[model samples]
Target: MSRGTIYNKDTFLTNVANQLGRKRQTSSVSLPKWKKSPQYDVFSELSEDALLDEFVKQCEAIHTEVIVTEMKEIQKVCEQVIHDLGGESLVYWEDPRFIKYGIDNVLEKKRETGMDIYEWSSTKGTFNIEKAERANIGLTFSDVTLAESGTVVLFSDKGKGRSVSLLPKTYMAIIPKSTLVPRMTQATDIIHERIKAGEKPPSCINFISGPSNSADIELRLVVGVHGPVRVTYVVIEDE
Candidate 1:
């Protein structure tokens, strides 16, 4: 049969109409415009110094060692933290200059401390998952915002895979203070902008408010159930 004759003869439309029955008309409600509210500053009350102080206190309260230093001094801190933790150090960076500088600084520190330093290569994506888990510490950058509930948003595409941050026993995220956001909604705005610009979201987007924690079982509090047991945020003040 001809295609048009076959379709008309089959009663397909009738069957579909019967199955669907009558369509209903519904009214649509417009969502409120994205607006910044005064409450956005609630989390911002913690000044840069105050935030660092509170961050250290929080880490110590959970028995995690935190080393606060300028971004330029990160290599030194990384070497020290790795030696002190007694675990092999793994460094991941996407920028070539920073990577070279980091590797050189780490090597120099390694010479003094006898700690092993390994450069993470992006070509080997899955190769480092296990190593990061066994690592004592993981370091990476943050696509920061000042209005994001004092939170840091880390994209796995930034070179530090999500596993590096999530599976490790301790995680140190380096976010510049200028990137600090006042609320979570502002972060959403940033995400929307990227999406609108036709950018794929990263493999993972971690909105880490604090360390991994839970109060799910019988109201007894627990920490690090699904991710790292310890998380230390280093706010890089100088841009």
Candidate 2:
């Protein structure tokens, strides 16, 4: 099979321009200036520490447990969280941030204690999903975090399977303080800038707000219907 090219695009456009009695435009279009832009104003005055506080408060409202720790204590704190959550088997993304944040050490220590640990791998294929489904805990790092809604953005790739955040019984996100932004406005802007700079976007970008919550059954609030039953955010303060 052969693929089609845009060989006729210019000819078609020239025909249209001729019909309209105008030349083909080549410059990029300018964005409109809105009368009022309130989206960028919210939480604009808050400092980074204040934003972190707001993020924590929002997490509480969404039923997510937030833990603040320093870089040196990451391994200890993560180990404690795993123990508290009764995580016997864990599935995490094959992200280098895990090693930088000391989570690799934590995973190794846990494995030495007989707990099963699985790292999402591109080479493993379907085995990644299988292990994630059976794992007790799923671990990932947030690429961007929104403070207003306590949302963590995950840019999923071959090594960073979406199953690592979706299929496990419990989900944990290691958030660096620098990733925290005001809200979706800033998050989208960051993503747009990256794309505008000619970088290819990820196949999937998930914006998760705490554990999954639903009220479909009898109008009663239920959590974790389609995803992890429990969600934890371990925020590194100095990072």
Candidate 1's TM-score? 0.65
lDDT for each candidate structure: 0.61, 0.93
TM-score of each: 0.65, 0.88
Cα error of candidate 1 at position 128, Å: 2.1
Q: Tens-digit lDDT track for model 1 on 6-69?
A: 5453366566666788433235667686577665565566775665565555556554455556
Worst 10-residue stretch by lDDT in candidate 2?
Answer: 1-10
Clashes (candidate 1)? 12
Question: In model 1, what is the error at residue 32, expressed in angstroms?
Answer: 4.3
